[model samples]
Target: MSLGSHSVMQGDNTLRAWRTGIDTYQEFVVYMRRDCPACRSEGFTTQARVLLSAAGQRSIVATLSVVEAEWLSSGDAGLSESAWAALGAQPGEPITVSHAPPLYSLSHVRAKVYGHKLGDTEFAEVISDVAAGRYSDLHLATFVTACAGDRLDLAETVSLTKAMIAAGDRIDWGRQPVVDKHCVGGLPGNRTTLLVVPIVAACGLTIPKTSSRAITSPAGTADTMEVLAPVDLDIASMRRAVERTGACIVWGGSVRLSPADDVLIRVERPLDLDSEGQLVASVLSKKAAAGSTHVLIDLPVGRTAKVRSEAAATSLGRRLQEVGAAIGLHVSLRLTDGEQPVGRGIGPALEARDVLAVLQGAANAPDDLRQRALCLAGDILEMGGVVPAGSGLTLANQVLADGRAWARFQDICAAQGGMREIPVAPHRQAVDAHASGRIVSVDNRVLARAAKLAGAPTAPAAGIDVHARLGEYVEKGQALFTLHSQAPGELAYAMSYVASRPPIFQISPTGESQ
Candidate 1:
């Protein structure tokens, strides 16, 4: 067959598209036989960038993944779920594969790599191309790495934030002082957004909060909230929820607010890199797009947290304030203690239980979680002018104590969707204390890693439950923390990690732990 403008020219190279049902997050991917006629004719190798078009109507650029299996015929092409959705193809639609167009924005990326700052227009073009699925994972990694380690100056960071906001839909609440909160995350079990939203909303403030899923940690706010209520509300549904209950907690990715942040997050998480400029851009863009006028950012600083030193936290906080102001967002930064995890539970369902316990005023609620949430909510209340500076905590406490927060929480949950009972992991095991002594320092990073190994966030019910706190004395056989997993293999893997590492909880013979 002769080659068309967008078709590969090889013997019978018109391939049938098959859905692989593989989830690649954001990047589109296509799988084909390594020795297929189209592959040889088009000079396509594994990981080559290719343009896929179907029915002359839909097209997307996807990275090629060559297979050496019989599952795919020589004339068949497999598309990942992202690619399938992008193309809107049927089960057996004919697909044409061709070379992708040159990425003109990559020149800007290269410039940034060479220590040159990108102009506003350049950043806009790059963000637009990235949002349009024109950039592959490789390109994305280069952009992320180039901008890492404070390489993006303040002006460039502001420009990037604006570009990110412009690349996606923005929510307009049509009201003044739309309030929200975000945590510069690192500490595990810091699910304060779940608590702060209810408290602030109970005070009759508009808090249409959008949260992200876990990237490197055990659970993100959305993951914990998902254990209680559906968090995948679309824009209309989100608006309805806020109209009904004055608040909503939904996953931000579903509403396409600052969508490039989501795409970049997929690349940034595996590298475990949260560059200062990118973090500022990522946070403020979402807030600005969500129509937030007043936002409180919780910055946790500790030796093991995201911002390890006070100096670093101060610098990040200043940048956040300056960027938010530039973008017309009233940002308030609060540096909180990040010496350990906030709540007793460090996973989705486990953390959800902690949130519920605090909201419902259960006697056994974790005090640290409750106190931290109250403090943050107080700051938000003060920022929004709900109460005076010193009385925000009193008012927030009253709302929680009088059952108003709980009622409002239930209303919000019902509005998002009907609230559901949080699940529990089927398999559980406790890591015992090695010796009887006072608990010293806890490595937040190590604990988070163990929870991830236990299948947290992904498994929803999987994570670690800390039973011992710093300075608390424990018996030799006492439980330091319990591991919860849906699968026994995951539980064993987490346990193996704990076994091979230095004690996650340091024990002291005398004196208080730092």
Candidate 2:
């Protein structure tokens, strides 16, 4: 058996499609036994890019993984969960495997590697192939690395953003001034989008916010939002939520907005490389694709944060504005203090609790989270013309104080499959202060990593909950932060990491517990 255009290569190249049920996130994988007839005749091995064609005209290029298990017969070819979904394969279906086609876009990537700037058409060719899943993980990594460390100039950045937007669906709200907010994330527990959305929506503006999951941090807006409400809504469901409540906070990937950005994120996540141009494109492309006319970006600058310094923030902020302008978005920047995490929680469910506290006006609510949310919401309000420039903060405060934001948030959550109860990790351990002193500084990267090691985002309830703040004095045995994990193993893993590192929190001999 053979496909017409994508015919099988010489030898018996057909195999029965078997579902292995392995989930590799978004990376597609095809499995074959080392001694399989097709593997031997076709010279297939691990990491080999193979073209797979299934029934109903479904096909995908997947990285090959050789298996030696007896359960997988030589005649059977296993497909990972991602590959299975991509091919829409059925059990015992016929599958034809062949060499993946040559990638012509890599030449542009090669040119980029040699310090040559790419044009719009070149970037488009590369991104389109990326969005179509034709590029392997190695190729994706090469392209990403070549673009890292300020390699892409202003023109290239704009072209890349345009290419990204063109690679996916774009929402046409058919209206002016659709608003949204995004944070150039690095600081953990900065889940302000949750508080800002309801506030802005309460002030009579449309905020169809589409957020992303974590790329290089413990949790992102979408991750924290998912802990409160269902975030993986389809395009129609997302529209209904926005129409019914004038706001929606859903994961952008589900709706296929900026599909290329989602693809690029698969590599960027592991590399921890949210590069300059790629980052601007990633943020602005989604905002532009979401049909947001006005956007407020929260750029946090600190020594340990993503931006690191005021100069870097300023440069990034300028590029953001320029790219937003090019993409028809009025981008506004707000550089906030990124000295430490925003809220007490640094994971999905943990951060959700803080969001709920702030929204419900709980007495123990984190003031920093509330105020930061208010400030960003106020900027969005002013930008969208809901209130004047100087009065936006007051109006935002009034909406939150009067419970309008809370009520609106409840409605939004109810529309998106109702609110969920935040989960609690089964295992908890506290990292105590080594000696009585004032907490001078907290390392954002280290804390975020610790939370990730505790199984955050993937395990929504697992993370770190901060109990101490900068300038606060603590006793020798006092808790600086508590590690929460769903399993004792995960808790131990995070504890081991913390144990082998420098103190996450710097302590001074004298001060006043804040």
lDDT per residue (tens digit) for residues 296-405 in model 1: 99999988988899999999999999999899999998899998888899999999999999999999999999999999999999999989889999999999999999
Give the clashing residue pairs of candidate 1, or none: none
The TM-score values for the models, in the order shown, are: 0.95, 0.94
* Candidate 2 C-alpha lDDT tens digits along 230-257: 9999999999998999999998889988
In candidate 1, which residue ranges exceed 4 Å CA deviation? 1-13, 22-25, 34-37, 512-514
Worst 10 residues of 2 by lDDT: 1-10
Candidate 2: TM-score? 0.94
